[model samples]
Target chain A: MTEQELVQRAREGDELAFAQLVTDNEKRIYNLCRRLTGNPDDGAELAQEAFLNAWRGLGKFHGESSFATWLYRLASNACIDFLRREKRRRSLSMTVSLDDEEEGRQAELPDQGAGPEERLERAEDRRAIARALEQVSPEHRQVLVMRELSGLSYAEISQVLGLEEGTVKSRIARARAALRKRLLAEGNFFGGASSTR
Target chain B: MCDCEKALDWISLDLDGALTPQERRELEDHLAVCPGCAALARELAALHRVLPELEEEVPEGFQQAVMERVRAEKVQALPAGRGRAVPWRRWLSLAAVCAVVLAGAGSLGRFWDRSGGTEPAAGETLPVQAAQAGAAAQAGAAPQEEAAPQKEAAGEGQGPELRLYTAMADPSGAREAADSGEVLPEASPLPTVGAAMNQAAAQNEDLTEAQRAALTANCAAWLQTSGLDPAEAGLLTVEAVTQTDLEAAVCPGEDQRARLDLDDYRVTLGSSDVLLCDSATLEVLGYLPTV
Candidate 1:
């Protein structure tokens, strides 16, 4: 069944249906949270919170949108909400490390394990991208992350964010420009690959 | 038309296949002759190919973690029996986890207080109670006596509180949400708790509109200036299907289907049930038959 169908069923007090959704998209959503929050712990928490919120709010979900879109909305809001709370609010910086993330992605990547040197190199690139991302506005960062990390189409992004598609496109374009600028300033954007200006 | 100016416009429209046939022909003609623009297009295409890179990978056992939490929450949903069996050590660990998760959903806490610890003093039956109870049961998977006890507490008519998720430090954050504004996306968990589930709270549409506007502005300001990365954020395409046909502008071709078209937005609120709407002012603009 479609994601929306699952949501409809779950809203009708179906725990199994909600559980199925948790199984189907948990990995992607978890990973999306991890990348955005930059900490496995926070990502895990946010993912859990989103699911809980989704399960509780399922009945209220209107089919005016796709279930994924609705889930993404909850997930995004969960992240924002998490950042606002005490005890876990660490300047919005995550306590999780990218090294551990590689160990996790290793599960899905072609190579289960990479040499330390290769892994370290990948980690550094990730850090660079993450740091660059940290410099942009949250809206811009959201658009970039949703576009780059969540792989949402412009239309989907627009729907999830309740913004016009032009706004989504413009923000993404600007985010790319900003990330390019920051990375360039750091002299790490094109460390090995030459970028044609 | 192949010149950089028109080329840029075409690039945007072409990405969505919105260009007319004649415009497509002219744009292609320009692409064929313009080497500089062609290189730029190639670069853009390459970037498009890597669009997937923008999305990232979740940590290991992310799902396991979610399931563990969900299971733990479910246990919490159980009556007093669930937590009585939770060993102290295990309970402590779960307690730590629950504290963290609930913090992530501040709306849950606020809602619970508004509804859980109190009832409308003069025999007011709240229809929104069902939403709160269900959420309390499902998400309140906490220590034993999960959500029921808290809501039952509210039902007994005691004090209540509402939690705000924002820091409200930004100058722009000063404005309260328009009670009817779409900015209050954080209203989800509140419904399950006391505040959101209480349709009576929603009865104050003026208040809701104000709150909604303020919340939207608060989020917008954050979206505009905050440096924090978003876990997920995107534009949503909304397609509006009118319940009535008289004044509704249905998209061509689809007899029973209508697209929720606004100025550059299109969504088909096709199948999902709408539980509540303060007003049906969701006016539609043009029709997107394709959508």
Candidate 2:
């Protein structure tokens, strides 16, 4: 049966059909969570929560958009809410201080060469970028993940997030800038405006 | 250096391959003169290239875990008592009435047909209508003589404030209906906009100011999820509504209307436009352009 048919059956309380639907979209949804939260454990938990929400909210899932699109929205919301709560907790407790010069110096890159050192530094850069992503505001992180990680086009990101294309465009630009600033602060990248975290 | 800001914006867009040829050319021209922008563009481009590597594999047994939860929820959600049984019978009868009214009353029928014609489900759709049925049933059993006593009780502060505030367009008529003690019928045939508006407005004298505040907050939260600024929602007029009012306000298509549940409120965003949102989850049902 088609996904719409599965969705219809699931709407009428068909668990098997719903499971099938879940199997189909699990990877992307999990990845969406992982990218959004920057944690594998949180991604697994949030992805599950998103599907559970989808099950409870199946009645609400009118086929206005594709089921996958709906799942993305749900997954993104779960991750965003989790991040917001985490942010609040961090703010209250003052965790993850950015001023530690030791931590900041951890990813400092050497000038260009394609040696083993460069490859190792590139891996650190990737890890640093991922870490920097988590530090960006949830709103920016969300659009960034949708654009870069989830591979959603601007139009699709607009659709998934229910934003205007123009808004999505500008937000992605700002999100990139935010991530870049974070990377610069971490000393992962060589050149950018000299601003401290 | 004046062009640096614009160049940076273009560079971000350029990473996504979003820059137009002319824009790209302009960026290149600017980059040739500006070393800072050139370096920023190269780094941003490289960052964008590696972003996809961040995509993680779905952990083993992920689908199994999700399915396990889904099965658990289904078992939990299936009504244990006669709760599910009662709504099904009531919904069938109501659906029949809705079918007849929709077929015979051309405009109103079309309105509801577009409004998804009231799905006979266990969740979201049934609960509100079931509650409406319960309310109507109580009102039916109560004598018209009790209306006077109730009004007196309300006057003496024994009841909630009897002030009628309907989100309907015809405010005066709503006041009149409330005075006459007209509880909107569950799935009643509404022929005119006035009557339809009446169908939309079911006065809850018992709904507290706190409850209304909660409903407004729920809508504002849902509005945020719907990609609307909560401040924008604050500017719109809000009213607590049952499923009937939700249907009336969100008379777009079946898909949109099916999202509303019991106690969803309508936020009148414009004279003709409104938003329907579930109170509990604060999920936006849809935006409606009600005529």
**Of the candidates shown, which would achieve the greatest DockQ relative to the real structure?**
2
Using all chains and alpha carbons, the TM-scores for the candidates as numbered come to 0.47, 0.51
Docking class of 1: incorrect
Candidate 2, residue A163: the lDDT equals 88
**Candidate 2 docking quality: incorrect, acceptable, medium or high:** incorrect
Q: Across residues A107-172, which tens digit of lDDT does each residue of candidate 1 receive?
A: 333223778786666545556666666665556667766776666788998998899987776676
Q: What TM-score, to 2 decimals, does candidate 1 have?
A: 0.47
Candidate 1 deviant stretches above 4 angstroms: A81-127, A191-197, B2-61, B71-291
lDDT by residue (A85-180, candidate 2, tens digit) is 887777442123232321332334444666997766666666777778877877898888888877888888888999899889888888888888
Q: Compute the lDDT of residue B65 as modeled in candidate 1.
A: 59
What TM-score would chain B of candidate 2 score versus the native chain B? 0.28
